[model samples]
Target: MRSFFKIQFLFLILIFISARLYSQEAENEKPFEAPYLFGSDTLIELSITTNIKELIRDTGKKSKYHQARLSYQLGDSVVSMLVQLKTRGHYRKNKNVCAFPPLRIKFDKASSSYTLFHDQDKLKIVGHCRNNNSRFQQMIFQEYLIYKAYQILTPEGFSVRLARITYKDSAKEVKNLEEYVFFIEDFEKMAKRNGKIPIYKDRIHQNNTMIYEVTRMAVFQFMVGNTDWGVPTLHNIKMIAKTPTSRPVPVPYDFDWASLVNAPYAVPNEKLDIESIHERLYRGYRRTPEELEFVFKEFRMKKESFYSLYQNSDLLTEKEIKRVINYFDEFYDIINNPKLVKRYFIDNSRQVRYK
Candidate 1:
């Protein structure tokens, strides 16, 4: 009887060890799916120039154009990026006018700082010591200031629009800005290239029709700060624009298929039932816990698809998803406790039985 009991106990011990190992493997071998979708290899080019008169007008009173030029280049490998000046000129210096110094922006990869050069000196835009953990945040904050300056200096009717701004600041007080600039002509070019011609009926400028185009243009200006520009000054600014450029045909290779399939990056156009998952979890569904657990499991297994769904989904709330992820991390630790192994087995057994 003593030997039999020992054997039974050893079997149980083996079961527990096996369960723990399988659980760990499940967690480790799980494929990572991002909750956000990301684009790849899009090129954007921008050109910044100053017309003497527009500059003078923006400055308020008539002043001579001070031989000033401003330019910058930024884009993600996956997005089509371009910037062109529809109308940019200087505001003349007046009694009320502030003497704004010319800025030269350069990117420092080593420190990841945007050093602003003016009057032959460098001004480092460092984040408060609290933000030392995130160098990207510090650089973004500095870029935002530059965007604000751009908006203030540009003309109201200017054809060039800001596209996007991306910045980071730990202090809830600081807002990081990433701005994207676009031109009206570029839109027309895009439309033509896409073989979607604007239909004009009756009205001279098709005022209502232009509204969509104008709105898109307006949004572009806000997109500019999305990339890392080495420095925060206006000098050595390289503007890259798409400029009626030919689109390259994608060539297929056997290796490309493997890369696409095995890529750890987010997949394009993958559909996920994020709203159903969110609702089942939040609305007190009977299987809320199980559903939530499965949702995360699915996320882990299909990380790329999940990321694309999260990024592309307009129906789901970003805040809700963020909250769930944060909370789930803690919950996972509790359930995976070694002391609670028996309870975990019972719970998982019940889950499997129900399924």
Candidate 2:
């Protein structure tokens, strides 16, 4: 009896060692790659400036504050852009009222630029001034405000807008600075220009002032290039100001196409299954335990939804989709283990329930 017990104990120890080794190997393996969504062909140019204390001081009281200037040249089409000043505020107070630092921005088509104003007190540009060069100060303030406002209004899709501005202090000395602008056109526009139907449009108002809160998504059959068809791509991405003035100002970071373009596209391969899983599960309004189980089980069996999710989903690219499929085919055995299922349920049950 003692001999038989010792043999059984040895067998159990070997099984434990093998399981640990397999788990470690799985952890060290490379992750699966997703498809590459082709970017727009157009290139964008951008310039930025911040920290304009002197300009601010001089124009603080003026009715019109010049923000920034935007110039774009696309295939021989050139237009000078401007943004009308709306309001401004200091950073310490009125965090909710306006973009902190008492600044509000509005688009002015007449001037073809955007405008900036101090506080949301009125629909006009205003600035403040202290000692020296009041006239030059006002001029600079106006021009800078126009330029800043323009930067705020231009959409990222028409990627060729070039911007430039200067920031000065009370002594008219240059302070902190940043300059460069990059535009990333929305995915829908790119598809449209490439002969695909656009998936999104801005909500238009009769007054011409855009109601930024609402957007309409297109639902129709559209051809996008030769590879993929019948799906909507990402849309309405705009280039937002990273730094408002010569000094750093918090501006909402929107879709940045420039960065996306520079990054290398991932190649297709079997290592992309995790991403496939994430993309498949991310869709739909609410998912339950049974639904989650169905996805995992079906995916392990070369299911269509598992592949279709990545292929039809506008969020990923063709190359990425193939990679995810490959990963699923190769690693299904490891991925579908019973232990993984139990652990996944325990950790993600609350999230699934809430969704």
Q: Pick the candidate with the highest TM-score.
A: 2
User: lDDT tens digits, residues 1-355, model 2?
Assistant: 9999999999999999999999999988956432211233222332223234433433234434546443445456654545433234332123232211223334454553221211112221222222243332332222222222223232222322222222223243655333322222333343344343432223322112121211100000000001111111212222122222211111112211111111122121243233321221111122344554554453344445344544554433455446545644543543356564444333432222323
The positional error of residue 63 in candidate 1, measured at the CA in angstroms, is 14
Instruction: Tell me the TM-score of each prediction against the true structure.
Output: 0.19, 0.27
In candidate 1, residue 204 scores what lDDT?
A: 21
For each candidate in the order shown, give its overall lDDT on alpha carbons: 0.28, 0.31
Question: Against the true structure, whose lDDT is highest?
Answer: 2
Off by over 4 Å in 2: 1-41, 48-66, 73-78, 84-105, 111-172, 175-290, 293-338, 351-355
Q: What CA RMSD would candidate 2 show?
A: 27.1
In model 1, the number of clashes is 70
